[model samples]
Target: MNAYDLVRGLHILAVIAWMAGMLFLPRLYAYDAEQNAKPEPLKSEMQALLRTWQTRLLRIILNPAMILALIFGVWLFWLRSGQGADWSFAHQPWMITKLIGVVLLFGWHGFLAGQRKKIAAGTSKYSGRFWRMTNEIPFVLAIIMVLSVTTEWTLR
Candidate 1:
């Protein structure tokens, strides 16, 4: 394998790690919401545990993975450009679509981070059902991104 292959592999791995956290975090939030409805020590204990898990997942896995994925993904784009790949939106609509999806994923990550802060503060307003519904966002975005890359779909 060559440099491009290596970078692409790393990008994929990092995205996989990021996606794992993206998919799991909201489910954790749902459980946290459920726990919030309980009473006494159990509520406090579960909230603390969930908060710890969310914090660790965000700080340890999600953040690093996202950074690495973005770095390697940009590297791959630069390498592709160097290799004479056309990056024009008209020429590669799929790349544009993939980019939009990635941007949305980044936004979702930020949203989750903000929610984590609210949860830690015991000020979160979202319900378990809300989190459950939002959990599908990453999965749907992943499918769109994968199809965009694999198919190289165009507007025409």
Candidate 2:
């Protein structure tokens, strides 16, 4: 009911939403990639997959989740220090690791979109090798996030 509790709740909720999206989306990509590899014709299936994931879910769900995650995170950080200029944040090893993970996640999302776009137009061949290979990206990013969250180890 208090300000700290409210922000803390929002922060936890946002992290759950964001982590769910990040963790599951990669698996979805794996499913989509396999489904795409089956003899269904690459162009049409690729187009459909790209539109649904890259355009629809990525834009509507993932994008907003990232923003909400960031907002709630900033709110939590502010609550911790009571100031936007809090240098103590830099001293927090977990926050630093999380920040790096977030950066990788952001780049991975954009990279997914770019790959989808490239293969969507039929200009580039829809290669299963390419899809399967790059699909490891989100997983790696997610692991960094997991370690960031659950580890007591410190870099600072």
Candidate 3:
């Protein structure tokens, strides 16, 4: 009904899009790796297609969505704190948990980057182990976030 509600709705959607795309991207990288590891080499057309699609996906879609989601999250939190609760960094369990998940999520990105690097260098091979490991990163964070949400303010 109000502007805040509209912004919050869009913000949630943006966060979902960003997180889902980010989670799926590693798998996409694995797919690209398959193509990249062909016997000869990727043809110029194939390379061009990869470059174009990857660039558009990240630059035009993922990055903007992530930035907007982050901004909107900050705004929503500020609104929440403004209403009553005090949100601080020093000693909130949920905050700390979320922060940890964020760090792990960043580390997950490092793994993704490593896979991409190895793929680019023509040294990467995808195995079940690799995919499982890469996929677990986000799942772990999702679990943490879910738990944090459910018990964040209660068990103190």
* TM-scores for every predicted model: 0.94, 0.67, 0.69
What lDDT tens digits, residue by residue, belong to model 3 across residues 1-156? 975787789877986776776677666565565554465545545655654565556666666776787788677666657544676532577867866776676566556556555655657668534664576567668788758855775434
Highest TM-score model number: 1
lDDT assessment of candidate 2: 0.65
| lDDT values, one for every candidate | 0.92, 0.65, 0.64
| Candidate 2 TM-score, C-alpha based | 0.67
Model 3: residues >4 Å from true position, as ranges?
1-7, 41-48, 83-85, 88-90, 106-132, 153-155
In candidate 1, stretches whose alpha carbon ends up further than 4 angstroms from where it belongs are 83-86, 89-91
Ranking by TM-score: 1, 3, 2
What order do candidates take by lDDT, descending?
A: 1, 2, 3
Q: Put down candidate 2 lDDT per residue, 10-36, tens digits, no spaces.
A: 876766666566555555555555555
- Where is model 2 more than 4 Å wrong at Cα? 24-50, 123-126, 129-143, 146-156
Worst 10 residues of 3 by lDDT: 36-45
User: Candidate 3: what lDDT?
Assistant: 0.64
For model 1, what is the alpha-carbon lDDT of residue 62? 99
Q: List the residue pairs that clash in candidate 2.
A: none
Q: Model 1 shows how many backbone clashes? A: 0
Candidate closer to the true structure by TM-score (higher is better), 1 or 2 = 1
